[model samples]
Target: MEYKYKLAKLQYDKEKNEELIKRQRKRAGQVFPKQLEVEFWQQHLEQARHNINQYFWSGVLIYFIITVLMITGDYWIIDRNFFKHDFIHSLLGLVNGAFCLLTLFFFAHYKILRPYYAYAAMAMIFWAIVSMTWLTMTVHTEVFRHQAMMIISMIYIMGFVLTGVKPFHMLLTGLMAAVVAMIMLLTLYIPIDVMVMGRVLVGSTVVGFLISKMLCTRERMIFLVMHQARLSEKINRIHAEELLHLSQHDALTKVSNRRTFDEMLDSYFEQARHDEVPLSLLFIDVDFFKKYNDHYGHQKGDEVISAIAKSIKDSIRHMDFVARYGGEEFVVLLPETDAHGAYAVASNIFKAVERLAIPHSQSLVDSNVTISLGFTVYKGEADIFKSDFLQRADQALYRAKQLGRNQIYYHTLQVEEVL
Candidate 1:
């Protein structure tokens, strides 16, 4: 009977060892993908390029429509019944269309030649002056007088509207105002037929230009105020988001803090439960961290922690999360990862931390920095609750600490089930 009892005890030990080996093999089968950071910024850059293209094409369409209208108006110049003769009317229409097309091309093709659009607009205003002079000097019919005056007035108003569309192009506005003033002054000396009509139209155009300028100034002031308000609101929002992030994240390492880790665990528990997917959690404590702090001082200790966090970030896939659970303690969340997968991730983290090799003179485990990890993985319809999963990992961590504090451990039941 005594020999039989001793044999049974030896067989139990052998089965337990085999189960542990089987669990390790199962975990080794799962591989973690490499992490990449550049993909995030590329998405935003593409969106900005798309918006610029859209705005440029819309401006081109507006210019095209204006050019078509000027071309059609040129046909009316040939009718002698009209106020102006065919030659003068066609000249005005052609000048307007040509300038409009030139401005459009400068804006579309050579963005660097934006200043040239103002010069082209100035040329258009010069033609307006010349047209008004010819209408007063050569045209004799009373019917032509009112028509010519109306056309000059329309040209001045159109120039003012165009200035509003491109407010940065001040040269265009100044040239148009100078032309109107010159035509008004020229009427005083020329004494051509219908001098009164020329003076009245010039005076009205100046008044209209001044009113439009005033309106533009008021609109700009309002826009500035609105812009400032938006800037202030945006700054406040950014500050709020930063504050929230800081509260939930480790200041030294920029990883999720202990409170955030707990909150995330609760959230993942619910999600995994609903989706019927596996969830794994890792409890990692840096081995001999106290000795490291003692050897390097608190400042260097902070740097070591930060470096480890970066290493963990580099090793894990984007879908996995790494958080600073507490002082020298870190946690990882692996969605859709089973017990075997979790052990594989934990082992990789172990290797990553060991490779850091931050010096610690007082450490019993090693003179260089290292980590001990405990992990748990749960799958569908398991009788285990979240607390049970955490307890199992915590127990494993305690065992690793007892076993010289540089190794990883998993639950016995999980290991046996795997075996």
Candidate 2:
């Protein structure tokens, strides 16, 4: 029973996030949706850049060594008379290494050109696969041609491992290698065994295709799940904050309600006691509000209350605040204020409500809407606790009703002592 709710909550959240990702993918025309734009690109680029940087120098060194060995081997050991055609083919092979280095440099120096890296990387990989086939074309030896074919397959699969943090890049490179290798073998006059080479090519490509399909599936699943968790947590936070706000406020009047007022009362009292400051509270009631609601209908009553609340809230100083204590009743709390300050605020609010001129045909006081107010201003008295001020204000409001309907009254300290 202890961890039951926690496990249930986790399950519920996972399901909800999965559904969110599914719906979002339907709407996502691009690789990354608008909300996850920053995260998606940041992760993708970081992985690509890290791998390119880590392997770039080592891969370049290997390419340079291979290029030098090819040129030197043709001239020194194999061919007694190396012609211009051999020179041209070796230079052409060296050009592929140059393109590889160029791709590395583009990634290192130019960050703003992020969109081009994928194309540049793909082109470099495609060149690596095809360049060896072309380089061995001029060499009429069976051994060199066979060795070159093996090198082509090796580089083809290596391209897959080299492409990091991408979904389809490895697959794309693998497909390109297979297509170009087969096309060159069939069409061009490279004196190699068609049967043996074709079999090896198909085998390696099947492995590459399997590797590509498997890796792409796993990485793509992880990426989607990661994004869903990030976005769902953000959405949950927003909803939680909204719920907290709704709980603390009156939905109808858009003001702080009784629950919030009660919390503030406790806090303000503690602060006032510590600082040896005065605290004042004003309670306001709409005069004959029940009759007003009955006569003018509840909708009009709601409008009148809203208008009166706005007037009261606007008329008060920023330091002093108000809340709807209950139905047609509002409380204003003023800290560090004496009797004079409380009276002034109460009087202003009373006048402000009258000035609204909302036709209150059922109000007993006047033709327009009016309010009766009673307030209590308390110094830091050791004998008095926080709740004493509320009682004093209530008693004062009762006396005001007994006397008349639409006037302001002050519950003095002398009356409290007398009681």
Candidate 3:
């Protein structure tokens, strides 16, 4: 029974690990919608580059100050006849100064710098060399051992704080630094407690590395959450805009539907009345449409209607409105248009339909498909109701159909003052 329990537990752990690995792979493959992945990384790199540039400048300044002090201290030591290594100190100061200038040059033109990972690794190695050289010199002098240890600890802490690398990368760097320090200490023949002090320094570096990894992991988690939230917001916004477009447009004709037409008409009517501008509404009918549908199939009828809608849309101005009112019927609202303009638009629409030249043997007026349009122009009249205006245009449409199928009829609303 005990063996069975252990086997079951092992199986469960294996499944859990597999599931975790699968989820991690899936998360790594995830991408933001609408090219936001590219944009996000671009923005992140720009920000990080700017910050790194600032850090480089600050480091240069600090190096400059420290080099100046080291030069002054070397000269003082020479004057006092205290240390014979003043020449070595002078060379190190010169080297540090040269390095400061090199760092400045690289950061100033970081734009042309290629292979970012290589650059980063090279920079870390350079700084590590400089730090180890200075620390090793201080150890050889044996004048400020306590101060040197404090400085070394601070260097490790700063490495954890300032290096903008992944936790794994940081761990590798820390290990390299520790190994280099251990090698340097072992080679240098110091008459002190080398073993105990070496262990203490190495252990401290390990602790600092662990702390750096924890901090980097937390920062990465926060960044991922924020990125996910931004992606979610963008998706929701695009989905909402798509839904709005679908609601307002006709699925078959790909034009404004009846509901959208009614809303636009009311809005344009109010605006025209307010501005005292002329507004024309055109009621269009496909002549002998039922007969055409009877001759052709319903699918063909749908295609014909769609073509008509497209022609009308192509003929009208952008500011003008056209919508599918119902089967074989359309409405157009032309704001700020006089009778002449309205008549010109209607004529263009007629010509556009004529251009299609769809065969219609069932149409009594012509062997080709044609449309009749009736328009009513309102000249800012508060007395005439919207329904009445539409009714008059509809009446004119009836008259066009009564007389002949393919033609245009119009009714102009005139306001007379009762003096």
Tell me each candidate's TM-score: 0.61, 0.58, 0.64
What stretches of model 3 exceed 4 Å from their correct place? 1-22, 25-144, 167-235, 381-385, 415-419
Is candidate 1 or 2 superior in TM-score?
Answer: 1
Better of 1 and 2 by lDDT: 2
lDDT of 1 by residue, 1-419 (tens): 44455556545544544453354345432111122112211222233233334555675577567657644654444445753564564456445545554454454345575445445545555555455545433444444444665565666665555433333233345455545545664665544434555465556556556665565545434433444455456556656777898899998998989889889888887888888898888888888888778877989889988998988888788988889988998888999998778888887888888888777777788888888887777664456687887787787777788888888877643656421
Model 1, 189: alpha-carbon shift in Å? 17
Q: Write the per-residue lDDT of candidate 3 for residues 1-419, one digit (tens) a residue.
A: 44455556545544544453355356643333335445544544454445656666686788779878866765554534435454465555457545644553464446666336334633554465436445444433454454456555655555555444433455566566666665665676544466755654565567667776565445444545565555456556656766787799898998999999889978988888788899989989999999999999899899999999999999999999999889999999999998889999999999999999999999999999999998888777888788877787777677778878799988665423110
**lDDT tens digits, residue span 165-267, model 2:** 2436555665666578768867776555677766666666566666755654455556778856765675576567667978998887878999999999999
Query: After superposition on all CA atoms, how large is the RMSD of candidate 1?
Result: 20.9
Output the lDDT of residue 376, model 1.
73
Model 2, position 94: C-alpha lDDT score: 72
**Runs of candidate 2 exceeding 4 Å displacement:** 1-43, 46-210, 225-246, 316-320, 336-344, 378-383, 399-403, 412-419
Candidate order by lDDT, highest to lowest? 2, 3, 1
Residue 76 Cα positional deviation in candidate 1, in Å, after optimal superposition: 21
Count residue pairs with overlapping backbones in model 1.
1
Decreasing TM-score order of the candidates: 3, 1, 2
